[model samples]
Every structure is written in structure tokens, then in C-alpha cells.
Target: MACQREDELQELVDEARKIAYEGKVANYIPALQKQNPEVLSCAITYPNGKCVSAGDINQSFSLQSISKIITLAIVLMDYGVDHVFHKVGMEPTGDPFNSIVKLETSSQAKPLNPMINAGALAVTSMIKGKNAEEKVEYILKFVRKLCNDPDITYCNDVAISEFTTSFLNRSLCYYMKGGGVIHGNVEEIMEVYTKHCAISMNSLHLANVGAVFAMNGVNPVTGERVMPKEVARICKTFMVTCGMYNASGEFAIKIGIPAKSGVSGGIMCSVPGRFGIGIFGPPLNDIGNSHTGMKLLELLQEKYDLSMF
Candidate 1:
């Protein structure tokens, strides 16, 4: 079965690769800029513990904003719905993920949604830990569980690059601290946020993590409930509403799946009760999603009628 799936998917990969040169790699992060923009890969993990792949599935990349969805789950479990919602909003923002304009304009001064940069940082601050290291450990442990790979860890180069260069994220943290929207040391929160954003993995590992969410919080391979059903539902809802940054609504109408994208050219997609997809195509479209990766998903959706809507 795996062989057949991979063979069939390879055709899609080849087709998708044709557009690989049409987009650009994320250049702001020095580490990310080192990626070859022409590279594209994909993996899909099914509920039955089967995973199939095409292209260079072994390629590793940071999660970037894709980490936002997982952190939200942790916080939701840590403080429950009421407490989590109070710190961050549930509405989607049409602005770019890093825009701080909404933070200043919102009546409550809270981030409009957890998927955006400001909201993700706010959510990261809510992670339970005595300090930055402990918080990072907790997040890594959870991610390792989700990926079903005990060795999964962050890329130091990427983490350091992001931490040092993320001036806008620091600004968001300081602004929120002043508004009483978030508490604790701003630098500590930034440390935890950047490390998690740098968590590195290949497409197969990412697909396994997405499979857990696709099965509604249960790790199909291990039969462990990593998160409650409610938590998973909320996270998936946010992914549909805000996962693609400002392009999420259009993606929903076109692709119709719950998915999250990272500027590192990684996209984790949960097809719900079916399978999960992980794609890495370093070239990014104008809105920051994987250009070739999006085409691959469109091909899959059209071939298999994968839309939930």
C-alpha cells in the first residue's frame, strides 16, 4: 500500500515541482534563506499507521508559524477555554501575520487570533514553566510525542537566528506586557517562542504529528490521547480560519482543509478522519505559503475529492 501511494504521489510531486521556481524562499531569516528554493517534498500519514512519501521527504526545516497551532493546544489544556480566550482572541485577522497594527487598535489589546505572530507570542507566554528552559523542554516533549520520534529537537542555528533577528516579535511582547495582556519577563517568553518556532523535522515526522490532530487528538500510531477532543477541535478551527495567514479564507474556499503553514516552506494539513499531509517546498508565494506545496495540495484535492466543505 505504501509503495502504491508513493508511486501515485510522485506524479503530483513532479507536476508541483514545475512551479517551484515561481516562488521565493523566506529571506528574512538568515538560516531559512540557506534553503534551496527549488526543493519540494511531501508525506502523508494515515490513521492506520501507514505513511507514504514523494520527493525528498528527508529534508528538514523549522516550523516557524506552524508551531502556533501546537502551542495553542498546550495553553488551552493548561488554562482551559475561558483563560486562554481571555489572553488571545478567536477571530481571524486579515493583516499579515506579523502586523502590530491590530494589537494597538483592538479594544482589549489582545491578539485577534493565536495563529498570527502577536497572538502566537501571547500564547507562547502562557505556556506553563518555571523558566524559559523548562518551558522549552515541556514544548519539545509534547512535540516529540506528537511526531512519534523521541529524537525530534529544535535547530539551534535557526533558533538563534530567529531569536536575534525577531525584533518585531519582541515589540509585540513588550506592547502586550504594557497593556497587561501578557505577563512575565519578555525576553524569557521570546526565548521559548523562538526555540519552538525552530523545532525541526522532516515531512514524515510532520505528517505523523498532523495525523494526531486528524484523529482528533489521538496519536493513531501510539493510541495515546495527546490532547482532549475539545482542544483539538479548537485548534483545527483556528487552522481553518487563520492558518494560512491572510490567505486562509481563499485557501478554505479552494482547498477546503484544516492546515497550517510556516514561512520555512512547511505546511501541515489535517484531512480529518482520513489522513494528514506534510509538505516542504521552500519557495513561498506572495502571501508566504509554500508555492509548490499549495499546488500539490490542490492536485490531491482535485484527484481525491478531499474537501471537508
Candidate 2:
């Protein structure tokens, strides 16, 4: 059965790679603007410990917003879900990812959920650390544990480039702080959050990370409990509700799986008790998700009966 799945995955990858160059790479940030639009990769890790990959699966890329899922998980582990919810709500806002209007106009200015930029920045601020460096180190430790790869490190070039031009994120942080949503220094939290987004990993490593959630917070490869079952369940709910920015509803309708996407052309989709799928293609659709990556997952879900619905 594993061999048969691998054969099918190869066919999907071939089809996905051909369309990878059809979209344009994200140009919102100088760091992401330089990525190769043609790079496409996919990897799937099954519950039985079998792994299948094709194309540029080994190529390293920044985690971008995908880091939000891992960071939110860590915040839940550190502060518990109830405590974290006091600062950020679980409801999805259909508005833009960085919209401050909702935060300002709402009775409570807290972010709608941890998957969005505002909520993730607030979550990053709540992470228990003395300073920016310690906070970043803590995030890296949690990410490494989930990926089961100690070598995972933040990409300095990407971090510096993003920091230099992250005016929107900076504005969001200040607004959150003023609204009492963020309790600490705005710069400190932004540094930690942006740094986490800059962490780099290949498709294979990301698939392992996704598998941790699919396996209910256990690292299937390392047999380590990276997060509690309840936390993983909540995170999965958030992923389904708000993971793909505003297109999450459409994705749920089409793919029927828990997944998250990053601006750096990475998508992490999980099929509980079955497999974790990772796709990378720098080109993005209008909503800041990878066009080809979304198409590939939709195809795989239809072909393999991997939908969670």
C-alpha cells in the first residue's frame, strides 16, 4: 500500500511541478521577492512511517506565516489554551490578515485567532521569555522538537530583509499594544515573531512537523510528545477555520483537511491518522497562498480520499 501511494504521489508531483511557474512569486517583501517561482516540491509522510517525495523536496525555504501554527502551539503549551484565549479569540475574521479596523472597532481589540498576523504577534508577545533573544530561542526549540530536526535555524538574510520593510506588521503590533491586546514592548514581540517567520526548513522536515499534528501532537518519527492532544485538536480547528488567510473556507470546502500556508510558497496539510502533506511553490494566488500548491492538495484529496470531512 505504501509503494502504491508513493507511485500516486509521484504522478501528482509531476503534474504540480509543471504548473508551478504559472504564478508569480510573492513580491510584498524583498526577501520573498527573490525566490525562484519555478521551484515546486511535495512530500507525504504516512502513519506507517513511510515517506514519499518528489521534485525539489530538499530545497530549503523560509517558513513565513506557516510559523504561526507552530508558535501558536507553543503558546498553548506554555500558557494553556484558556490563558491564551484571553489575549486572542478563536473566531475567524473574514477580513484581511492584517486588518486593524476589526481590532479597533470591536469591543475587545484582541486578534480573532492565532493564525492571523495580529493574533500571532500577540501570541508571540505572550510567550514566556525575558527578552527578544530568549523568546526567539524558545520558539526555535519548540519548532525543532516538532520537526525532530535540531539543525533547523532562522534564516538571517530573510529575517533582516523582512524586518527592514515590515511596516504593516509593525503598525499592527503598535495597534495591538495600544489596545491592550499585547502586554509588553511592541518591538520585542515583533522581533520574536518576525524571527520565527524567518526560520527555514525543507519540505521533508515540514512534512514531519505536519505529521506531529496529524498524529495528535506526537512526533511519529521520533516518538516524542511535542504537544498535548487537546492542544493539537484546538490548533487543527484553528487551521481549518483560518489557516489559509481569507480563503480558508474555500479550501475547507474543496480539500476538507486541516492545513496552513505561508507567504514563502509553503503549504502544510494534515490528514489525521493518515498522512501529512507538504507542498512548496513560491508563486502565490491573490490571497497570498500558493496557487499550484493549493491545486495539488485539492487533486490529492480527491484522488486519495484524504479529506477529513
Candidate 3:
């Protein structure tokens, strides 16, 4: 379905863009530093195949931490909930997404949740593949199916940059490996993890993926099951509890939707069975969430009474 532009949404985007200066684009990745911090865009996809968008919706961005939800879904389907949770806890962490203090202080080395960098690395290690290439292909194939676009692929430059600089992620992997929470070559796991995190897409495609989860694992446009209903439930639960890094609780209290955000200033939200929302605004608050995008969502929630509460 053609996405019909909405003036109302455009107004919201304009309002949110004004706060872009309050935040900064992620610079640690090197590749993400090139983004325009003021750029803001949004797209919403419905079960009836209707879509509405505003702002710079065409600009593509890396998935970053948002890919964690997708990879968690894939691994949950490959391995049962029992096996997956055995490796990563379902609880959220109050510390930073990449912090390793809990990994060393916790009773076990298993990551507290899959949304964090440590847990994401552990989950990536579980993807069923003989090598990094095949594992990436498997993830891409699933992402393509969700977007209904076979051309979807990862950003090679971003992948390489993240792979080379992800010393913290590598350390997380080794810590888990030593604890018997994960097994494999550390470099191979890093290769797959970085590539999946670097998977790039515009706001519209991201909205579509969010819709798949909104409809309980069924692709709204294709009317096909993407994953089992239970898997989708687990993924959504995580999104509610841990998706927005450490700000998830405040987000839940305010916006009240199941959503995930990335360091690249992308937010993918599911309004239960209603619709899927995708937003990109490169400037991030101290918590690493899209500063402007969060404002936009707050505006939406206030305007439409969107809170599921």
C-alpha cells in the first residue's frame, strides 16, 4: 500500500525536531557520526495495509540495539524459551546497556536481558549457522521476510567499524564463554553480532517490521505467520520491560507501548494490535535513546490517548 503523508504527523515531527539540539548523535561507532542530528522522520503501518509518514522518512539508519529484539525473536524460534532464557535472564538492568559490572557481580554471568549489549552477544552466538556468513544470511532472510523485501541487507562499512571497535562486546562474549553461557570463536561471534546490528533500513521498512510483531508474529500485509504467537509474546514482553535501554520503565509509564530504540536514533514501536510506529532522529539523550523521537512519541501519546494503560 502507498504510504499517505499526513499533515498532522508532519506537525509533530516539526515540533520534535526543535529539540534536536538537546541531544547528540552517537560518536563512538565512528560511522554513526555522519548523521544529521536534527533529522527527524516517522512512519506508521496498520493491519489494514494503510500507512502514514512525515519528515525525512526516506533516510536509512543502522538498527544497532533495535536488532537485538529481532535477533532475540530469531533465537527464540530456533531454541525454545526454556533454552534461550537459560542463557539470558528476562529481567531488565538499571545500569547502562553496555555496562559489565552486573556480568561480574551477578550470581551468574548470564546477561540480565537480551536488549543489552552483553545479552545480545550471547543470543547472537545461538543463531543456527555453520559460520558467520551463513548466520548473517539467516538473519537477513528473516528480516527481509518481515519487510517483504529481499533486497534488505547490512551496511558493510558500519559492520566493519563496529566489528573493529567492539572491544566491550568482545569482552562480554569472553566473560559469558568462560562462564559456559556461550561457546564458539570470539571473532566469529563478533562478526555476526556486528553485521546484524548494522542492518540498515528506512523508517517505513522499520514500521512494517514492527507491525509484524504488533499482529502477534503475523505479517499484516502478507497475511502470513512470521513466527509463532508465543515467540512474539516473549519478544514483546522484553520490548516492554527492556527495549529502551534503561529508560524502558519511564517510557512504559508515559508512552505505554511496546517499543525498541537504537543508538542510531531509530525507534520501532508496536501499539499492541493497532499499528506499528517507526521513528528516526539522530540526536540522542544521555540514556542513548532518540531525544527528539521520544518527544514525538510523547506528543502522539498525549494527542491520541495512545497509552494502553
| Decreasing lDDT order of the candidates | 3, 1, 2
State the displacement of the C-alpha of residue 74, model 1, in Å, after optimal TM-score superposition: 0.5
lDDT for predicted candidate 1 compared with the true structure: 0.92
Model 2 ranges with Cα > 4 A deviation? 1-7
TM-score (all chains, Cα) for each model: 0.98, 0.96, 0.98
Q: What is the number of backbone collisions in each predicted candidate, taken in the order shown? A: 0, 0, 0
lDDT of 1 at 41: 89
* Candidate 3 global TM-score: 0.98
Which regions in candidate 1 have their CA more than 4 angstroms from the true location? 1-4
Tens digit per residue, CA lDDT, model 3, 1-309: 223459989998999999999999999999999999989999999997678999999999999999999999999998898999999998998999999989998766988999999999999999989999999999999999999889999999999999999998899999999999999999999999999999999999999999999899999889999999998888989999999999999999999989999999999998878888999999999999999999999999878876777
Residue 90, model 2: lDDT of 87
Per-residue error for 69 in candidate 3, Å, reads 0.5
Worst 10 residues of 1 by lDDT: 1-10
- Candidate 1 TM-score over all chains jointly: 0.98
